[model samples]
Target: MASQRGRLTMGLVLILLAMTALAGRALQLQAIEAPAYASSAASKIQRAYTLHPDRGQIVDRNGTVLAASEPAVLIFADPLMISRNGIDERVSMGPLETQKAAAAPKAIAKILAKHLGGRPEDYRQMVTKTESDGSLARYALVRRHVPSYTYDLIKKDLAAGKWYGISATQDAVRSYPSGTVASNVIGFVNSEGQGGAGLEYALNKQLAGTEGKESYEASTYGRIPLGRATLAPAVNGTYYTLTLDATMQLTTQKALASAVASTGAESGEAIVMNVKTGEVLAMASMPTYDSSNLSAATSNEMVNHAIQDSYEPGSVQKVLTMAALTDQGLVTPDSRVDVPASISSGGGTIKDAFSHGSLALTARGVIAYSSNIGTTLLTRKMDKATFIKYLKSFGLGATTGIGLPGEAKGSVPTASMPDFTRDQISFGQGLSVTAIQEAAAVAGIVNGGVYHSPTIIKSARNGQGEAVKVPVSTSRRVISAKASAEVRNMMEAVVTLEPSRAVAGYRTIGKTGTAQRIDPSCHCYRGYTASYVGIGPAENPSILTYVVLNNPVKGHEGSGVALPVAQQILSVALPRYGVEPSTSKPPKAVLEYQP
Candidate 1:
């Protein structure tokens, strides 16, 4: 009996000890580990990190701000939070709470209508519509971009602090100050901050800054403490300072616009370059777009015609021929040739604009009169190999190396051509080139026979006004200094001699070209490509301008239409650049007749 009672007491003690251990474990879980586990659960419900991006700014060479970033707001909604009361079976609302449920849709509609000032019917319709998932009795907006003013109104009138559904977030947006001026070059951005065209597309990586990350802990009530977050501040993007002078760009654009409008031409392009440096001072193309509103213009209007389009350069190619002849020591300003009415070559005959009866003409006279027959005769004196070499050296049959996108290389005959092909190319036919290539060629002629690669960007800058110079290649002397001068002098005579191509008292040198357009149907001439290229201050020659009119209706000759426009642009542009007018006598015509 004693052994039995001892065993029973020990078993009772073991049971009490086991119960105590169980009770202690329950207290420990409720008191010590609960808060930690709750925190871990909360972390899963809320995302820990958010990214912030630094916006870029754009300024002109003069430091005028063209584009910058402005703070904005985004609005969102949670339908689950708003509709929970209507479908809950475990909890029942009292009379007042039940009354709130019936009126919730109307109340939300009223608030949205009052703040956003839209039709109440639209809001009511949005709230009452059934979602694909029948579980969601209320509507939830996936995302919405709202302006700052509308956000302010929502915060003031809706009392969103007490409501559980509405959410407001902050963001950055791009803003332009100069409106449509230089819009084509400045370009624009999409909502995601991606650049679309022009400088925006060219320097996107530099302009787009690194994104930063943010993390925070939120309470069950969705309130976040200020000190409990980890943040890495974003680094701002670098600023771009272009070489474009806003004033000069505007002036050029206006002139081109006027020319396009008055002449009723389909499109127009104008560019101004500093003769000393290859810095493009001003570049403008008509049918431009507003960077702020890209959709406002058609795709055709957005093209940068000066760099993208190429056509037969017509008489402008004569500048290259003049350079080739003089540089090879085969000709001089006074070198004379017997210019005939026309000459037969290979399988075709080359003709002049007008018949010349075996007239004796100097090398300079041929250029001044722009005779196809005379230029062809001059090319024959020089063999095909030497001609092709000089043409390539002048940057023909190749790209201008301008960094702009969609630039055409401009076509030139690759191999040794037949007599007809050589004759046509000598007179600026059977070849195609861009306006920029023509301008660069002219720069080679007047800028001491050196060719400098053209560029639109001037320099890049930061916020402190400190600048980094853009890399530029040194100018290469493509022809001798003496040859360049001889060509320059002859070109000057074209503008100054008899009935002067340009206006008097301007001291400008130029060449007129009228090339027949190739017709697709008959493979013969149907229209004309008229163009004029000129340089000012005939003695020093500071500015060079090239203008081309494609298929003009009334007068399709360069002298008739293109020369006057070139003269007007140079007249204003020269004085603007501080180039002094020349007081020297105009070039006198040199003439001789043959029977």
Candidate 2:
């Protein structure tokens, strides 16, 4: 009886011990491992995705769109998700099913080719590609930047055919609506949807905007209904309003291209500025490619020549020299000066463009006739320090403060410059200046001596479409108003020299430049650079037009080649901008002094 009781006690002890162990295990699981298991479960079902924001739209001042982005899709494939053998999770299939599974890649390729416009064999290769480890590739890019409607068609085909593993994601594509108009300024977007050049490159951070992300619960088929989801909405890029007139830009481009073609020039560049505001109304560059078709562009064609390139501006430099001399009380427009047929300077003979005897000429006559020796003689009277100070104030030996990528800050001579070099520069040689710099300097000289830094951005809007305040351009006084007026009047004589240069009912003032081209490869003079800069309504100049032609094979003279282009640009720009006609004829100057 005692043995039987001990047996029962042992059985009861064993039962109690088993019960205690079960209770301990339940507590451990509920308290310690519960959070970890829950987290793992959530991780298995949760999916996160990047949300790309729409890129900004670049528009003209008049709301004309230049560049924009459109919605698209990236079609891709998961070869690993597709079954190569007729086995479902290690379960073998029948012979018929196996045969069908083996033929799936070819059949899938056929359906893809029907919509994507590629050979079935190519698609099959993409779908059947393997990794270096001899395993099926996990992911493969089928096509990117596919139109939404086209992808919808592809999706419909995929659903009807019950094709698996192929999928698509959202994307965007940058587009240029105006094609080549202001292309060099607007620049082009690279394949990665990033700005490649010009303003697009300079302001990329502001224009690209910020990306966002979203997390949600998903299943094998699709998103789970009533699933836990969190979204961080994307912020679209800023909307830029450039100070460009699209119509005027197109006009300038066409005129410049025509001039370049007719003159057999290597390339051409032009810039039109609003004198009162210093806004670049139109900037054009020739040998330019279509902004929409960048694949056909050459490296040279992509250059923004107006600001990127610099050259010796020939007689155009005379305007600045004459202005400096007049401002310093060194000479007057009517001051008499004896100009010989030729003068020896630095072991080189200097003469006017046209041969002449030892004729007497007024200071204004030197500019009117573009006499090289006469300009040299006049430059000899001015001190180098004062002349260089005036040039620097006029935006030389420095950038014009025009916000552009790859702008050239042209070189200038210092106070200790050689006399020969000074003589050469007095007539627009021995120094370099860009088209933008020269244009802005001349505008400053005529705009009551105020030098307003040039600007291309007129305004901007934030992602939410709220108007953002754009910083106004910096301005400073460069010369006296009296001196500026004198220079303006002196330039009128240049216009009077050519009857055809006068616009009907509009008084014009300008300077022509024809400097030898400096070859970059050899650093030697190769051909000639023809350029012209002009302002309209001489009494109150409003618009400034500048044109440049590089290495013209047919004609190398600024008057014959570049002046016509400048004239064409001004004729259109003046009328388009509502610039008033001249109120009175300019006072005729005494070009020659009588004995």
Best by lDDT: 2
lDDT tens digits, residue span 501-584, model 1: 665457778888898887669978888877888788777778887777766776778887778777777777788888877888
lDDT of each candidate versus the true structure: 0.73, 0.86
In model 1, the runs with Cα more than 4 Å from the true position are 1-39, 42-55, 65-67, 74-146, 160-170, 220-223, 462-469, 498-505, 519-525, 586-595
Give the 10-residue window scoring lowest on summed lDDT in candidate 2.
81-90
Off by over 4 Å in 2: 1-25, 76-114, 117-143, 164-169, 469-471
**TM-score attained by model 2:** 0.91
What would the per-residue lDDT of candidate 2 be over residues 1-595, giving only the tens digit for each residue? 9999999999999999999999889888888888998899788667676677778899999999999988888787767555543133346668876676677787778888998897998898688879999988746878877888988887788777666667777777788889999999999888777899987898787788888888899654557999999998778888899999999999999999999999999889999999988999999999898888988999989999999988898888888898888888888888888999899988988878887799898988888888888889988998888888999988888877667799999889888988888888999988999989998899988888888888899999878899877656778888788888888878899999879988777999998988888898998999999999989979888999999999999989999999999998999989889988888887987799886
> Listing every candidate in turn, what is its Cα RMSD in Å to the true structure after a full C-alpha superposition?
4.9, 3.4
